[model samples]
Target: MNQPNTPTRVRAVLADDERLMREQLRSRLTEVWPDLDIVAEAKNGLEAVELVREHRPDLVFLDIRMPGLTGVDAARQIAQLPEDDSWLVPEIVFITAYDQYAVEAFEQGVADYVLKPAERERLLVTVQRIKKRLAQRQDGASVPDVAEPAGAPLQQLLHKLSGQLNPGAKPNYLQWIQATVGQAIQMIPVEDVLFFISDEKYTRVQTARIEALIRKPIKELVDELDPSLFWQIHRSTLVNARAIDGITRDFRGRQMVGVKSLSEKLEVSRSYTHLFKGM
Candidate 1:
């Protein structure tokens, strides 16, 4: 017996600070995708995140420059959100003004982007791409054309976009650390550090030859270090990517990262496991 497949009902959430921009995007989206259900709207990134958590929309259109928690930040948080039904993660489409550099960065990533003052032609292209991705998921097949490839994770793309928007935000990452070794403060070259494990009080900085203690926590270090160089495997641990020896699974089948020149393996928290998806 043959049965016709029902069309998938696509739901979406829109986030933008300007009312006019939101309306414009909504109207255009409706024109391009009349069947798309605009489940909710948000005025800022924070609100967008909350809306996503509530509605679990299939798509999210986020404005890059928001008051607090820029679109990139919101996307990072959304990516780490708990996934249950295998549908919690929605396809993200960034909304931004026309910036040559920003657009160039977007082209290198898997996610699509719409310029401010949305154009019908461009929106149509984005709509088509989104439809393809959603259809692939529904069919229980891999996204042949849009899957995250090497150097194209959402986090990496967000990092590039954030850098483009805030050029001087972090010109140079921490190159050296002042850590206490008994009575003396040692100048530990950041490259020498294998991993950082932080507790309530101090963070332990380990290297092949020596270990030291620093007051800076892993959170602060994450912001101060170049993300391309250091990968945050867990909330309390950040390991240098270049220093990674390999990856292995523990007894519980949890992913663990092995550091070069280090015997102890660091566990990758469930939230940050996407960073090692190659495994």
Candidate 2:
């Protein structure tokens, strides 16, 4: 970690497969901290490692999960570089959209971490600390514990892992999904659904506007909704995007995705706007 006032130039490398996440992160990092130079950026772990060796940056901000090798695997490779390896050991900061590492990032010796939708203030704070740590390392100072916040993040990650392990083998995006209403259960094809609305407790699956209450949460239902056609307009609703006639904002300026086959309109949250990439 470099001293806060040190004259050191920070060399960095960034990695993520999602083009938006990667480009945005790099652009923001460059804009905010002009002293830092980004040597390379990669779309996957293998590329990241290759870049790491090529550039030998002083720090790396990495996304842990990628198609080929995980961020952790890349970290291990960084950790295992032989003494004769010409590159100096660089510090690591992790970034993730999933809450999977909110706890583990801290537990590990990682320099820092930022959750998705990182704020400018947070980025400034993180960058300062990283530079400070690098300065301290160069000055032969002891590294302080930058452990993660305990308990809650870990619990959330465990729950997520369990959910993934048990993510119903029966994918929700099927043309038909199992439904139970007042002890009468059956599989309902998507074509049968008139619309879906989120209630405080459960999502109401309506067919022809006759509501059938189901216990499945909307988050899980998002996966069930066909990504290619169905869209989650709001946290409370999932609408068949293809079925959408037009989108209009309501009296409050909140956007709604309206369907052609049904009068009931659904909300579209900003976070899910990406689902409409082409449409």
Candidate 3:
């Protein structure tokens, strides 16, 4: 007879600048999830990112406002991390002490939000929702490198919170990109660009007339550019929605995107295939 599979224990990382807040949150979590293993704790957002990268925990509870990198910034970095068999992205829960103005920005269902000095009733509800999501992921783990959908809602929520944190400051999306050509710097209007492909060091900007390179990475550009105008087709590539000519399938059944006035084709990463669903 075959042996039954063992249940995987959920692990988590807790990040809060205040020791007392971290302790209180940990205590409450223990009450709700007795079997949960909190593998690590961090005192700041930078530490939180490092811990998460090292532990690859099943969940993370991050205090929204931390010194240096804010929780939102850290979450952006975490979301951009490369996923593999050993490290599937963990579910994130934002812990905030802000008033209703800030709390209202969190989108329902993308992830849970907990107020400071968490009440048992509210925390339990969040716990139950997370449990259901974990159960679903467990069932789906049989697929090799399962492609999780882009967390667009979460990204938008984060963007809103960023403004809330800054109070008077508003986010301005990118309008122009400065790329260095052979001998001079050229300012390219965002709409005129065909697509952006990036490597570790530089991003190549392609336009109908000329191609140039910039030092910005795709991860940073995703936050600055208007999501509706430029869609992220792959981890390393972002294509202009207006410049897309058509999408075709390759022999391996991967979706390839073609740009207007450009022969180069961009492959849509599995995580971003939903962008082409309607087409």
Candidate 4:
């Protein structure tokens, strides 16, 4: 008879500003995911990022808001770690108190999240999902590198949350883009931009009247553009929502967006299909 295989141990780190919250989460995780090893704990977002860099654990549970650095900011840094470090980016499960970030979280396709106080049932679901994802990755699945601009959705979510929290503070979104057209610099109103597509070196700006190129990439543009006006349909593409006429499916069932004024069709990646689910 063949011997049974032993289950692989999963390593994890828990980061929260409050000591009590960290203890409570650890206790709950122990009850739910017994195989999960708590390798380290952090008291702040900055500490959390450092811990991740040192341990490169399989998972990280981060408080959405922490002292010094926010969890979203920490995750951003962790996702952009240098490849030379040879660290596998850990799966992130944000622990949040606010319900407003839920939609944004789902839009980012995050691994999982646990509500504050850490309920056993919810943690179980998260644990199960993490296990499935880990197995898939171990089986040679083609997972995208975490340290890529594909995380722009999370950045946009963070920006929205910050604006909501500040209340009185209004973000200065880019109203116009200055692009060099031959020898003259032309100021193009952001509202007039139909879409932006980035290649290796530059981003192509398109409008009904003109097409121009800029040095700014889609990642940088995502921060400056108004989230309400633009939707990131792909890693290298951001389309003005007002310009989107409709979404259609190709012969292979891929989602494609038709622009109202432009004749070009935009291909939507599977990762961003959630943006057009209703359509």
Candidate 5:
């Protein structure tokens, strides 16, 4: 038996880069609302835009990351539909691995966002929320307004990001160490160290002392250091973020960046090139 002319039923579109997420959501949606029609599925945010424009589904489930545009970025774009109330704006539900972005998405007027590997019970709740909104729509009501900006709370969440330096941990942050230059030994600050150069036998800390012998290998030191401050430029070299002063293009269109403390240039390998762009 079928419910005929159920104009109030929620028709939806689904978008995610992962096939498993799409399939799982499809099955879950069927379990929750057997009558709900999923009109289309998109592989990426760009395609999601095209699909929404063409199919005009009543709802969409979008992923945060894909090959091209991100779901959050895409949602901001779709929310810009013509101001005239020619057609009701479709409801949206975001699915993401990162919980930190939930505040931003919620602020952007998405009805609800769910973390991936969604439990069936939670999915039903979201469906119920949608139903409640639509019931009001059938009678005549405005959608729920977004909660107040969570910018302050977001700062705490964003602080979970990696590469924080804890100077008090074990050994002192190794500020000043002795290095042998020519015939004399000189003291140097760890901050002044441009890079650590490693060899088969030992590692040299290239501070203003010209190059000091470090007790720890470059590999071991990288593990202990804050990753944001120091980058492993090569298997043999670890560079300080502050030490880099300028960049240059080689004849081959590759890059070689120079450090402030030393005359020697550092090679930017393809794998590590993105670090320079971020800088």
Candidate 6:
């Protein structure tokens, strides 16, 4: 009698900002692909990148919009890793709620994405495709380079998003912010703001004179603010470009941004490091 050949085991990582979503995805994956081993789970994009570097999983499912670093930003950094790194670049699968990026996702042929609340049938299809690709790699067959066609569509999508956020028809940037100061409502000039940090509920507005809180989150404010005047140094942090005195390096060699006349320093994550590339 011939011995049976065991199926290949696939290692994977899942990154999502929501714990429930991660659990749901893991549960679904387990039902559809039992051989797929989920080695780790991340709650944010930064954690996702770190987990990928640590685990070197065969595949990673990243949520498109995560706090600290967006999934696209994380994927870009992973793709740019040095060739000599010990771990192979894992196949990426973006999990997003928006359908607008479908065209761009298709252009990046290397990636296979699933929409949020991943349907079992759709995930089964993705799993099959991933398995095929992995088999090809193991057989020493040439895998199509998905990264090659990714650049143009990614750039186009970014340009379109930027234009949509700040259209020429709405050239006026938000000049004043209405925030609660103690019991009274105060209107602060946008220029006076040093930075804006968002939490689950509200955004902290920091200025030279006072600190205030608002119900608006960073996502909403980004569309209203002037991109040239304000730079998104991190997913949750928006710094006034004019207020940026300089960027310094911490002991870990990570970039720390200093705002003019402000005591606090903003730590720049890997995703937004490009904004201060030349500096």
**CA RMSD, predictions in order:** 5.4, 17.8, 5.3, 6.9, 17.5, 12.4
Query: Cα deviation of 175 in candidate 2 (Å)?
Result: 49
Cα lDDT tens digits for candidate 4, 22-124: 9999999999878789999999989998998888787898888898888877776665443232335677788888766645564555435788878899788
Q: Model 2 compared with the native: what TM-score?
A: 0.49
Every model's TM-score = 0.66, 0.49, 0.74, 0.68, 0.47, 0.51
How many angstroms is residue 2 displaced in model 3 relative to the true structure, after the best TM-score fit?
Answer: 23
Rank list by lDDT: 1, 3, 4, 6, 5, 2
* Candidate of highest TM-score: 3
lDDT of 4: 0.75
lDDT (0 to 1) per candidate:
0.77, 0.62, 0.77, 0.75, 0.62, 0.72
Candidate 5 global lDDT: 0.62
The deviation in Å at residue 84 for candidate 4 is 17
Over 4 Å off, model 5: 1-7, 83-86, 103-110, 143-279
Backbone atom clashes (below 3 Å) for every candidate: 0, 15, 0, 0, 0, 0
Tens digits of per-residue lDDT for model 1, 11-84: 99999999999999999998998989999999999999999999988899989888898887787777655556
Order the candidates by TM-score, highest first: 3, 4, 1, 6, 2, 5
Displacement of the residue 81 alpha carbon in candidate 4, Å: 9.0
What tens digits encode model 3's per-residue C-alpha lDDT throughout 122-222? 88977765765566455442122122332443455566667677879866899999999989999999999999999889999999999999999988998
TM-score for predicted model 3 compared with the true structure: 0.74
Residues forming the 10-long window of minimal summed lDDT in candidate 5: 154-163
Per-residue lDDT, model 5, residue 106, is 50
Candidate 2 at residue 104, lDDT? 53
Per-residue error (Å), model 1, residue 86: 12
By the lDDT metric, which is better: model 1 or model 6?
A: 1
